[model samples]
Target chain A: MSTRRLFERETFLAPLLLSPVAVYMVLMVGFPFAMAFVYSFSNVTVGNPDFHMTGFGNFTAVLGDPVFRKSLLNTFIFTFISIGLVLILSNMLSELLTRQFRAKWLIRFLIMMPWTAPIALGTIGYLWFLDSVFSPLDWLLRTWGLLGKPHALLGPMSNMYWLGQPGLAMASVILVHVWRLLPLATMIRIAGMNSIPREIIEAAQVDGAGYYRRLFHIVLPLLLPVISVTVLFSTLFTFTDMTVVWVLTKGGPPDHSTQVLASFAFLKGIQGGDLAQGAAISLFFFPVLAGVAAVVLRIAKKAVVT
Target chain B: MANVQLIGIKKHFGGVKAVDGIDLEIKDGEFLALLGPSGSGKTTLMRLVAGLEEPTGGRIVIDGADVNDLAPRERGIAMVFQSYALYPHKTVFGNISFPLSVEKMPKAEMQKKAEWAAGLLGIGHLLDRMPSQISGGERQRVAIARALVRKPKVLLMDEPLSNLDAKVRHTAREELKLFQREINVTTIYVTHDQAEAMGLGDRIAVMHDGTIRQIGTPEAIYHDPANTFVAGFVGIPPMNFLEREGVVIGFRPEALLPAEAVPAEESMRLRFIVERVEDLGSHRLVYGTIGGTKVIANLFFRTPIAEGEERDFAVSNRDLRRFDLRTGERVRP
Candidate 1:
């Protein structure tokens, strides 16, 4: 009958607690997603969003193009390479951080700096760090006489043109993204490592299992469920990511070498003003991410045990 | 099997001395129970012997070999941790055979040894099951079996039976005593339970404040304690203390009984003011104050007693232990 009494009801309180998030998702995410789905099947342009039911015309046209094909292949290569490096580096870093040391607090704070800082802001900082003429990396190489020297390993180029050459640009993009995503993966790994009981490690030692044996047989096997969950989340981030490609190379060097699905979709829809084609291009990423999300949820369930 | 001698062993975690200046020697094929309350360094001393904790100052000699710098695996020791610490990911067979696998024993020999160990513990049927699928008592047995599988020089048990139910613990205590005798390996078992120490140990070392207060056969330690700490620690309801002038005297609860029970030739009478009485299954614990100091009397049979009643109790002269009033150390006559 009154405000407080009305809120006391379980049915009323439950929906009230959920309404803000539900409303935001339906308006912001749900509306755009529905529009994209419709646009992908219709002929819609930026200048004239007058939609006509075209029935997969945009999808077939986009698929036939060579640039989109190259971008699609490039997306897989970029994602897989970056995630591989992230996995190895994060595992090593987690092991180092899990041990007790004098500098642990300082080291942990510095290790988590990238994740705590905004992704877009960090990428902008990298824009200068990997510039063509002014990159500190090339400056160091030149200062060491490695790049400008005639018989040097990098060879007679005064500058490496980090963002100009197709291969170098792709490499730069992959490395930059690896650096950005590493802190998150490493934190997950550290949390996983901490959850294992200390007595188990000591028991292995007393049982005559050496250091590496304990790690491989005891630590790693117990860490599998956690590692799988970390891998799943990392996969989703890399698969849907466009910011690194956009900020570092703009999917560029003319061959579309570093272009991924997310970046190319933005280029085609918003910048190239072919909204219908861009919508169709991005639709390709949905099924892959959905599959990954499903696996992650399943692993998350298993990871909760022990 | 080997004798373990810890000479002035000390383990300091920063400023906290978990185990400080302890000297103890356990003989080959002997079962020594380290008995103490928590923070008494009983567990820390066992961990030091297991090589799990590094000693700050001491030499650990196992069969004349200095093992202070050696890793636990290199020291030829096996331990059953308080939590059992079974490899959750491994099956019972895998858990038992892990050490053999580390030794690089032949696959057939390793499996045979593992099966033998499991069978000895009556857990052969659970070999295919993972640790999570087993009950707590079975898990404890599996841990013990894993430790015994390798037949190391010394076996250290850190409250291994503490996790089991009361009925299971009692059965485990009996089985463990039998297992130790059969194996005839030197053992150092750490526990806070006096009953466990009394039941399973050939010798019980009572510890307090990082140092061993007394070490002797269970009968000797109980009958003749080195100090007040041991006398008070190793008995249920502990020993009662009464200070008079400069002398501190302690007597066991069972030692103080009705005047008719004590022998007349060595009798000392005291006026006891009864405050409460607790009826245990086989005994009645009489609570009272003798000359304003609290004392308990464990009476095995029913007696005519009431609260707030003045009663005369007797203690035999031989049963009373004398101590130094200032330091609480036993002062023998």
Candidate 2:
């Protein structure tokens, strides 16, 4: 066959193969995103399809609302704290798992159970575990004399309102998010650690690096890119997550103090019947997430070991 | 500089004996090469000395101190791995200075030491570059520099030159020998290549089946191998063994010559039917069968020999090594 014919065949085949994916994306993700963008600028509401472009009026309203502003702040706090905890805790877990031990597979399996179980189910489980009256944590604390007058720093002697208090509720959400994301980060770290040549670690040992030295100087430096990617993924996962908050508090505690962007958007857009404002509030996620993803990816690129 | 002594060292992986009982005292400032084929346990022995592997039964002594319970770092040894093991993320300067940095050495002093070591290895210009940015030879130099920066009493190199190309290996080997002489460190080199061991080692230890088969000066190991295994393993075109009654006669190809070219009182003569002749530039290898036993003889390319021709070859009596066929141990005269 002529070279030109072969080239023509390849070019034609490329688009033909890609067309299904392109069509699927347009129908599923692309259409909804485009509709959301249009709706965010229009005065559209439930059962009122007829509307005219409001030109940032919905954006102005959403941004001006105190609850929307609070939700935005909460989203950042939730994502940052949860991801920070995930990064530190998962690194420790991965390092521990990588060492030689007995029953390692079983330990790893148990650690991964939180991630593998359905998030909704796991959140519900946590809800019961932290229940106001019959909480295991409160029981343990009370039994240990960590509650009441003598141990004032540990909180009241009575059953602490876990999901009912603003601070405790936020901490609970962040903790659950960290627990759910730890397995993936730890697994990623393990893979990164394993990819390092055994000789490099042995060389470090021979060069007089102790365990901590090897960890800080050799393993952690090599894992920088992997860690960055893990943080990025966990941040994205925690930022957009509403199920945990919705299931536990539904952005409650009287003042919407623990309300995050996703839950607030759900309450305002879907439940409150103001689709335009909801789309505008949800649209706030795009630029912040994009900025975060860009920064993380750049850091990951710079930290590439090889 | 310090001597390293391994007494009754034994390492076993489940049922497999990686390094069986071994006892050797490496002299201070002496270069020793542990030479063997793959699975010969040379690397295992090196790791035992470096404190990288724990011996099942042994005492490792460095500089008159028992270091069996010490970690590799505490043992004060540095190694140049077969893969070079240059930290991929670190610059050459960072890699070379790692040992010092681990000790929290002052920045200026660490820089000076690293630079000096880099200069010694002729890699000073590459210090700012990452290991990935350097050539294989440069990486090897960086690894060596890293090992040298700490000024360890003993240096361990595990096939440090095996990763380089052939031409580069030749120059690196010479430079390495010169560097070792200048530093005067007690060095243990591990390699499977006989040429590398012979060229670099003050004394070469030949290992087989997780045991030291022979240990001697390179000259002694070459001229008077302690056993059949060393005799066979230490030479290129390895020594040919021919069974004669209860004894096995071993002789190198280079030891054999055309009968006419040898004086009568100097060598023993054997006749064989030539099967093939391989002309290798300055010399030729003649393959033949003697009494139904195959043998090869290295001859000058100009020598008059042809395939299918019956020829007489001579080997000096002293050149022929005798061993018990069943035991495969050398018989001393």
Candidate 3:
């Protein structure tokens, strides 16, 4: 009876030990999601400040807003370009550095520095480099005759607003996101490359596979999980990120031209006096990111089996 | 099948020599095993022959043609890795067909060859299954099938049966031997298991510290081991080693028996205090000590030797393998 009690005590203590983490998750993650869901149904504007229930009104208001529609389109455009570039460039660089050579650690360290740098600081640096006048980039380009004269890249050049024009603004944001995200993707890909058994590669070599044959048939297929996870994370970050846009354009020269969902939400609730709509706009990003994550997770799982 | 020759092959990893100066002549259609413990350079030697690794020095000739600059595929050889190295994402059919596909054989011909190899390995029924779905022995068969489908001049297998269960490894060993005989390809196999090496190799090259200690038939390697290492390494429970006054004496456990059974001139009586006795169904193993040296002797059936019992043991001169105590080499006549 005492032995049975001892066994019961041991098993009972397992869940008891886990209760702290479970409580923390419920309070932090579950409560916020519940609050967000509740806020989605309220007509809680910032100035009026009344948390009165309003069934789906804020969502319908967002769907009707031109600003919200533009933000949605810009987010998709930024994510598509940035994630695509990150996947391709990171995979290529990782494959190159996977080979044994002199100074490999040094090369890896240099490449990974961008990822280790603070994002706010990196974006600030980008802002300085792309400054319209007295920019080193502009000076170098003008000296090479690539551009007409010493001018800020943010200015209107041939009816194109690099920071305000819809297409160019999206492109600027996408390029910055890719630059910042490349190091992470490259590191993950390198890790994936390292995990592949040496015997497998040797087997392929002994089987008569040349470099390209080995890369395409063996390496790429094995690296799919890393690639998928990287693409998923970058997609989420690029779609919702406002740091680079905020630092460079402040969401725009002409009122909110570069506003993505995140910056738009900030503008609406804090500056424009619509808390309920802002909450709804912030929540708009959830489904899209969740869907992409789900698909990538499925792909990653399938890749692990191979 | 083609004969292979390695002339002064060497490889160094930083400051360490993995395959120190070594040469081997492998004849056509012969099954040879590179037998050694881990880090003894057997696998490294096999890789050099397969062209999976570049030799730091020397030349490799296959079928009278120098293949030093040739890649593995170009050398007309195939290797089965210790891990099986099957494409886990590929089906059994696809795994076997990889070499043929790599060679750019016609699709129909590749399929035919894969099917033939699968049939030969008795795995035709599992052609559509992935490598993960199969047992270790089945995966081993698939790896062998992949190598066979290539129709290479030589086959290199590195510790192929080490991953399987004991019974499975035993069964696979026989099947591997049968397949090698039927194919009659010049094969170089590497293994740490001396039993597998003895059972499979037509000629076994025993290696130590990146060099070949001896190369001979299995019976010769066992009965007349070149040095102390082979004598101690070749048998189950290994040969019992004893040293006295610069003379290293060794003999198999079965060779030692009760003194009354043998003629007095052919045997020497030694006294030992029993430490333990174990009954292992078909035989018994006695653990004891003689003149401060521990000794193990096997008996045909369960015997009446008890713990702490003292007894007279006789070892025949013909069965003893004597080596120099100082040098650890065979005391050659």
Candidate 4:
């Protein structure tokens, strides 16, 4: 075949192959995003099915709400705690796992079980486990002299308010988020450790580097790329998650505590009949996510991992 | 400098013995090469000496101090791995200064030692560059500099030049020899290459099947190999073997001569069909068969050799080695 004909044939077939994925992405992602953006600027409400252009009114009003402001702060606080805890706990766990031990695989399997279990199901289980009137932990604590009596564990004085109050509630949500995300981070770090050539480690050992010095000077620096990627992914997943909050607390006691941006947006659109305001609240999440992704990408690029 | 001794060292991985009851003494200021084929336990023996691996039984001593339980650092030995295991994240200077830093030496002293070692390896100018940013030869030099900067009494090298190309290996070999001579430290190097064993080792230990087959000076190991494995493993073309009277008779190709050049009364003549003539610049290798027994003879460059022709070669009785065919152990000189 002539070169021009061959080129033409390839070009003609290229889009045919790409069409399915393109159409799927549009249906799954592009369509909803476009709908949300358009609806945010319109006076769309569940109470009044009829809609008209409101031109940034939803954005201004959502920004003006004190609860919205509180949710934004809650979201940031939750994200910071969750991401920070995941980073630290996962690194420590991976360091422990990387050492020589009998039955190491069993420990790893148990550690990873939390990440693999269904999150909503796990949250529901936690909900029952910490129920004020019948909490097993409370009964045990009281029996063991750790608590005064088998009182309601989720009551205000029981410090379950950490999971039920505003700021502390956000911290509780962050803890759950970290529990759901730590396994993958640990696994990734372990894999990164395994990938380093044994000779390099031996060289370091012969150079008189103790275990901690070697870990800090050699292992951690080599693991930065993987750590960065894991942190970025965990940050995004934790930042946007609503299931734990929705299922555990339904976004509140008086909505005073436990209202993050994701749950607040769900409340406004699905339960509160303020669809435009909900879309506006959800859209605000994009810039924060994009900023995070940019920083992660920059850090990943600068890492000198080999 | 310290002498290292392996007292009946034995290492086992489950049921397989990697280094089985090996006993050796490497002297101070001597360059010793542990020569062997793959799976022969030379590398394992070197690792044991370096304290990278512990012996399952027996002990290792450096300067009369037992080191079997010591970590590599406490053993006071530096190793240059075959991979030139320089820290990829560190500059050449940082890599060379690692050992000194670990000992908490003053920064100025560490810098001076690092620079001097770098200069010795001819890598002084490359000290500021990361290992990944340099060429293989440069990286090899940097690894050497790192090992030398510590100035340990015993230096362990595991096939240090096996990663380089031919020309680079040759130059590195010479530089390594010069460095060892200048420093006068005891070095135990491991390699499968007999040429390197011959060139760099003050004493060459030919190893096979987790034991020392023979240990001697290069000339002794080359000219007086202990057994069939040593004979077959330690030469360029290797020793040639042929079955004779239910025994395997072997001889170096260079020991054979054209029948016409030998005195007919005293020399034995073996007639053969020439299969091929390999012209290797300064020498010619004649591949032939005598009574269906494959044999090879090496001749000078100017010899006329042709394929598919019958030729006769002579072997002196002293040059032939007779081994029991089944056991492959030397039977006669």
Candidate 5:
């Protein structure tokens, strides 16, 4: 009888318990998405409070611009390269971290320091570190005879214009993004590694699997779903990210080489005062991101460990 | 086939001695069961033999070569874990073919070997199915197939049938013994179930407190246990140890008989006050007290005995075993 009463209370109170989170989602996420949808279809701007519906005009204008096209491509390249590097480096580091070692907490803290720092602050620090004239990187490279003068095997060296050149600036942004995402990915991979049964690893060893064989066959295959999740999260974060590129290069170095969709949207919408085109530009992220997420989630489901 | 020799092998985890110094030899193609209760270091000893754990002290010799420095892969051994440890992501075929692929065996040869092993284990029809899609018994067969596919010199099994239901476990045990016989691989099987060890092992090593108390054939271990531990461990209802003067008298439940069934001159007789009788289909268990010691008798009769009735129970002198009171070691009369 008490259990039945508890059940009745649970049934009665479940929705009441859930309503706050539901309402919060509606206010925080749903409302913004709906507003963005409406703004994408209308010519809304800061100057004019009243606006009329526009039929694909903003999209057409945004897509017609070569800079917008370049931004789209840059966003894809940056997200892919950064996530790829994060996956590889974090997998290696997570494997090492999972092993028994002394001073492990210190190593973990050092690796996590960049991720724990505010992005803008960390990127600003990178900006100074990669400064062309007075960069510590340049100083180290010069000391190693890889910059500032000709050396054996290495061609004549000079100060690398890290953010001054288009290619170098893009690489720099991707590197920083990889550095920022690595700690989280490594943590996730470590959890995945720990979740695997120790008996399975021992069985593999007794079955005569060498180090690489055990890793690729047993460990990697079992960790597929977790790896997919890490990739999906990092990809989403890097794809729409504007902070690192904004603080480091601000989509500059001429010809808009390092510009990505999010930065491009911000530049045109808020700074350039072309709010309609910017809303349309940012809306482009939706379908592509959704498609990628769908594909990855399907893979994750298929590879889920039983 | 290879003989395995352990020479003072020891493993210490920090300060805990998981496996202390031990020495034993396993003849080629022998099925030796490491029987012990939990935390008795039987599994740790098996792991040390498989090269899963490094020994802190002595050497493990396989086929006359010391394998102390060899990696598990280099040791040429295969193990089936208690959980079965089937690769969940892989199909039955893929799981069985894992070791072959590691060796870079030709695809056709690997397929044949895997299929042959699956056929041997009677899981040939389920080769394409994922491990999760199969039943517990089928997964057990798949684990066996995977281990046997490599045809390693030595096989280690850590309670392989422990995860199966009782009904499946019996059948799996029968199949495992038959499979081991056919393969003739030197096998070390670890189990806490004395029934499993007795049914399958050629010789059973009863381990306790990080050391082997006795190693012998099932009959030898049962009829002439080296110590009180073995006598207590090997039987189902367990041997009853009644405190006597300088020693403890041990006797099986089956050794007790009705007073009238035994001659008065040949057997020791005791007065028992019947407390309860348990009907177990083919047999009945009579629980009673003799003097101050509680004693149970296995009676193969359906006749219900009244509770609180005093009766005489007789145990043959030949069936009685004695153990030292202090050391728990067996004492010959």
Candidate 6:
């Protein structure tokens, strides 16, 4: 009787069940954020190991560097382009994946390979693919007379120098990011597509709406909410991620052409021994992301089934 | 308006046959109800006609044209799903105008036609409301309005009213009947409810296990069933049967009456033992055994017999139906 009464206490059981998550949040998330906040406001470095309050110093130092500015610009360019491609490719893929096909399991598994495999492993694999001289992609272009040979397809050029060139390196980084993020977005979209009733789609077919008409008018409108969520998550992951850029380019050629805010911050704080500046640079995206998050939330709410 | 013909239509899902060898001809502007229990291929047959599913064999011809290769849009058809399937994101006006927009109709003309369709359904006042903002009944009208906006060759509906409350369904049924008459469009309505079929169908096709058992007017189907399945499926508490002499004798519960109440010149009498009675307000259901065969007698008038009593009951000669015991086919008298 005593144990039954104890178990019946809603007030006690609810908090008890939630304690582990609460503990994890405080220790894992809250503590790190608090430390970063303090470090951003103070002058702390790996060399000195001292906390001296110097408000705006780290922020000013980061803002003044041309490399920091270039990285800030690069981050936006990479994220937006990658997200744009991810949206288009993933939407088309989700549409195709939702329909019946032969060996669909293999296609889905292959599409998900980029995401399921370790990020470092995938990026390392890309290194061989984008190698300046030995890349099979360059070899294919050469065989097609597009990379080298006089008066070829893209004007005579030896090796194509994929990672060696500024423009090509940035493009390569964005493509890698798109490839990494696409499967997750496609899966989310497929789930959204499935949630719509089959009868509703059939109703559209009978109502004289053809394939394109149904896609634009009916399917896309209903999937708007889920798509917004997918875009938001992918945006956050891409904006704050350094893995792909780090492994493939490492902000190479000393020009910081493919440098993003996250990679730049890692370079400064963890590698360059300027812990204070790195924390400040890392926190730079907080306000921008927060603004984006607010807009997406509003859009998602409106897209919800009324 | 157009006529639809299904010539030996069959649909097989792997090893399972959802519809098998169904050949039905729907007259121009006629409302035909495909009636059957669930998994009886009524909906599958309807889908085949709508060009939603391609049959494993046979052809579907609408308005005298074979629509084997035609898409649903090219065939000119519309459907109201059981859920009413309104675009939750679009307002009623947007939904009604969607099909017209597909044709790239002039915006002004599209708006006018949509308003006209909405007016036909008396949903003109709800033009601006989103589907999620409307009631279930209103959403159904919007779905119908959308279907009608295009003025398609045929209209197909799958249990459109089964989602409504009982009180709402009655009025909606009345409205739907009136709307169908006013439009005079060829329609195929699929439903499992016999009452809905009887209320709406110009002719009802009763189906079972993938093949149609019978197709006729409500009066004909109720009065003359082709087989035991139709006889057993068409009515509530169904037709009671007693097997005797390699023949199955079936009669409606209402036909089984007290000996004195059945004033027919020739009647079959049975020694009935009362088990229990259910007072259904409008009628009493007499649950009892007749010649050791469990039977139900629907009596409009109260009887004096109580539980544990044995009495004489009779079925009028005209009301008795006989079927072959082995085949369950009605044996011609």
Best by DockQ: 2
Kindly indicate the candidate among 2 and 6 with the higher DockQ: 2
Could you give the DockQ of candidate 2?
0.74
Give every collision pair in model 6.
none
Separate DockQ for every predicted complex? 0.64, 0.74, 0.51, 0.68, 0.72, 0.67
Cα lDDT, model 5, residue A269: 88
Worst 10 residues of 5 chain A by lDDT: A150-159
DockQ of model 6, rounded to 2 decimals: 0.67
Report clash pairs, candidate 1.
none
Steric overlap count per candidate: 0, 1, 2, 0, 0, 0
Model 5 C-alpha lDDT per residue in residues B1-333, reported as the tens digit of each score: 799999998988998888888899999999999999999999999999989899999999999999999999888888889999888888899899988988899999999999999999899999999998999999988998898898888899999989999999998899889989988999999999998999999999999888999999999999889899999888978887788778999889888888888888878888878999888888898888888788888888765577888988888888889999999998986
Of all native A–B interface contacts, model 1 reproduces a fraction of: 0.86
Worst 10 residues of 6 chain A by lDDT: A153-162
Q: Could you arrange the candidates by DockQ from highest to lowest?
A: 2, 5, 4, 6, 1, 3
lDDT of 5 by residue, A1-306 (tens): 576686579776798789999999999989977877888889998788889999888888888899999999999999988988998999889978988899999999999999889999999999998897888987787788776775623345567879998999999999999889999999999999989999888888888787788888889989999999998999899999999999999998899999999999999989987788888888899998899899999999888575
lDDT tens readout by residue for model 6, B153-264: 8999999999999999999998999889999999999999999999999999999999999999998898888889999999988898998778999999999988998874
Displacement of residue A20 (Cα, Å) in model 5 is 5.3
Candidate 6 regions exceeding 4 Å error are A1-45, A48-61, A143-146, A154-158
Error of 1 at B311 (Å): 3.6
The residue-level lDDT of candidate 1 at A178 comes to 92
Candidate 6 per-residue C-alpha lDDT over A8-69 given as tens digits, one digit per residue, 9 for 90 to 100? 89987899899999999999999988888889989899989677999998898889999999
Candidate 3 Cα outliers beyond 4 Å, as residue runs? A1-70, A96-105, A140-171, A211-216, A251-259, A265-283, A301-306, B240-251, B256-325
